[model samples]
Target: MGTVRPNVLIILVDDMGYSDIGCYGGEIGTPNLDSLAAGGVRLTNFYNTARCSPSRASLLTGLHPHQTGVAELVNNDGPGGYPGSLSLRCATLAESFRAAGYHTHLTGKWHLSNEREQPADTWPTRRGFDRFWGTISGAGSYFQPTTLHDGETPVPLSDLGPDFYYTDEIGTRAAAAIREATTPFFGYVAFTAPHWPLHAKDSDLAETRGLFDEGWDVLRTRRRQRQLEAGICSDDATLDHRDPAVPAWEDEPEQKWQLERMEAYAAQVRAMDRAVGTILAALEETGQRENTIVVFLSDNGGCAEELRSDPEGADQFRRHHLIIPPTAPDGTPMKVGNSPGISPGTADTYTSYGQAWANLSNTPFRRYKRWVHEGGIATPLIVSWPAGGLTGDVIHAPHQLTDIAPTLLEATGVPALAERDGEPVPALPGASMLGLLRGGEPVEHDLFWEHIGNAAIRSGDWKLVREYEGPWELYDLSADRSESNDLSAQHPDRVQDLADRWQRWADAVGVIPYGDVLAARATMPTQPA
Candidate 1:
């Protein structure tokens, strides 16, 4: 038989730890994911942009977050709408696939655009995807969401009744969509599970209730060791401790709530894995499993944001003034906060395990999600194609989220289209990895990352990373993947050169555009080496 066009399945999990899955050597029960990794290549050094929306933007557009106008999160304004909304200048993965004669569908979180004043046309359907069944807002109750959408129309969670959990529902919808899709299809299944609100069914939570009660210290050590054994990190490298914000486990008194919260989070992951198994089964049943190129990854590192505890803009308002109506009525007074003592499963309690727990989640990586350190941006990437296209092995080559779009285009023999808006889209910044998947060396590209004041530049084996409030820290990733050594003093000249190159690239691609965030970024030292 003649070779057929490969279908694409991009499975995205939210806030997943790098070492949490069986493929990465953690104890998490992920049979489906492990099977995929065993059949295909397990990417050992895949890097995300360190956050959700930005990473998604890069993954879909083959460009940096700044180039996509979502350098931070979505910030909407007047009638013209949010600049952070999916810009017309860039072509999304679905847009390209649809142009290439493939059906496009998405079922999960849609954090890209949610501006009230913006016209309905700015949403996913008009943007590119043929169909979208998911939530429009950033994060919400997994059981009852505020802005759930089934394609272009608004849908209700209650429509599924009390039995509807968003994670399971997303998987079911995706499986149905996959089975019903005509011809070559591109399915982007983004799950927002294991992210927040620590709400899981009693039966689901029961699976991991006492799993985390041993505390963060033990968990952190265990995960780090496992990662080293899996070759995700170097065994000789030192694992960095938690950030200053995280309290030592020795100081923690109320351990029960902490344990329960993590149990709920783990349950979410397990449930998502079950969903993945369901979708994979659907693909097998459809007899398209062999020809399908399945790529699974998380957007960023484990999120440490305590929605109610942190004093930020929208977070502050939501934490202090949240009002859950008695029955979705007008002006029903309510307050939501992530208090330490309150049990997580209750409706009133809004909580996050905080930085200490986030440290445990990231294992050996230096920082959490927002920063550019290994832990903050590194993610587990598993790609499976069983028609003798992809082999089972571990690839140590560095990969970026931007590579996803171009990789898909290259694999399916699709061309990159011209931009719609007058603003010309930049050239493909990512190289094709088809050769690497076929057991050849993947082309190397200088990887760069920046979010607000945090910045990192990677060229070959050396990486220079700087946190918002921290000093410039350098590491030769070949020797120190955990970023435990500081080579800044020894390699000052190289640091200066790399920083300059990164700045020039950033300036060319609108990394620090004019905005409130830019105003703050402007105040930082013009050049730091």
Candidate 2:
């Protein structure tokens, strides 16, 4: 008889940065995640797809986002790559594990399907998970989210009590799934905390009340120092300059409101950490800790979108057709943006930390989410498996989000199938990290990323990247991981080589031309949900 497989628990958070958790250099309280890092392995150079839907798609299937039919967000825009849904040609990690007799359960965001009306075919339950609970959209009100689902059925916010919190609910559902499992389980806890609409509990808010008074400039410098001390980055890695667009923190007039916004953001992060502790405790209580593989990572870097009502650009920013007005549970008006009067952390308010703070959250990395920069793509990856012999160590090898599915399969002894449902699926593009986890030599492979028109390709230590409609930039990531230095002019031949490699990969994966997608998106009435 074969030995029983180890349980797999993947905890994914939305819109968090490379260094928000304690283990990754942030001051936020994340003892549970820190403990995981202390006992397991931390991948310093891990990467993601730089956006929500694409990152989720890559992580779920061991294929690039374009190959998985989600090149962009959940909007059927250009062609085969941007189908706005998980393609039939792919098999999700949950599906593969469930077929191997592992009980698969998913709790939290499910943004894979574009047709929410007919979610039965693409929802978690139909996609190999035995059970499912969470939102179907990418972002929404934490208090009263739209399109909340429980195994293909719509779960109204009214069904939940006044004290209900989305992050807590995800953790609770994940714990319940872990406890009820009769067989080795594959549990996915996707928390939407610290994303946007910055609504956190009063207690959580109180804990971080004075935390951000020092402002983003100081916070950024402090985090960079901490990151260096923690060995999260190389000793010689220089901190990227503060974004030229963001004003100096000292010159900011709305200090009080700005501080409060950061406090709310930190509160959201802390609350998410607390939820992780709850799930970890449940793992211990259920006696699944020793043989369970717990993997925790963020979907993307900190978001910088200002989803608020701006009076200066009333025609543009305040357009009801463009922006959906956020509302509280009782239908009370919830104002969003950098408005001074409207303090965040309440259900009656919706706001983001803004670009300055997001820059701080990313700490030493350039740009924010959506761009093909280190800040947009880098993520802290924590993998803990006591039975797998993974110990406290930092692996600096560059690994993409797509590598996660194959890693889990290998760890749990589940075989990757060449075909599923009688269709020949594309071969897994990601290599398993099992060898690295066992303290073996790091694996070498080319890494690729594209969202909208922004694109990048990493071959060995050299990275060639370009923004939408922008010129190509090259950097030796081994020395300049922050991408501060553009070495394109110095290495024209290398630039052409990497660019050629990216073009071939893009074409092979059926990635629609960026210009075509952008033109199509311009004609569309709706903005990303």
Residue 500 of model 2 has an lDDT of 96
In model 1, the Cα lDDT at residue 317 comes to 43
Candidate 1: where is the Cα deviation over 4 Å? 77-82, 116-119, 242-250, 309-316, 319-335, 346-348, 421-424, 513-529
Model 1 earns a TM-score of 0.91
Tens digits of lDDT, candidate 1, 213-292 = 77887778887777777776766667776666766677777677777777777788888899999999999999999999
What are the lDDT figures for the candidates, one per model?
Answer: 0.76, 0.84
Per-residue accuracy of model 2 over 1-529 as CA lDDT, tens digit each = 1376899999999999888988888988888889989999999989998988888888888899988888778887643226688888888888899889989999998888877645756677888899988877777667777778888888866798989888888888888989999999999888888898788899898899888787788888888888888889986877886888988889998999888888898888988888898899999998889899999998889888876467554334334321233456778765656688788888777677888889988987997899878999999999998878885688888899878888888787798777878999888888889888888887899999888789999988899999988999999888898898899999999999999999999888877878887777766656445
Q: Look at candidate 1 and tell me the lDDT of residue 387.
A: 74
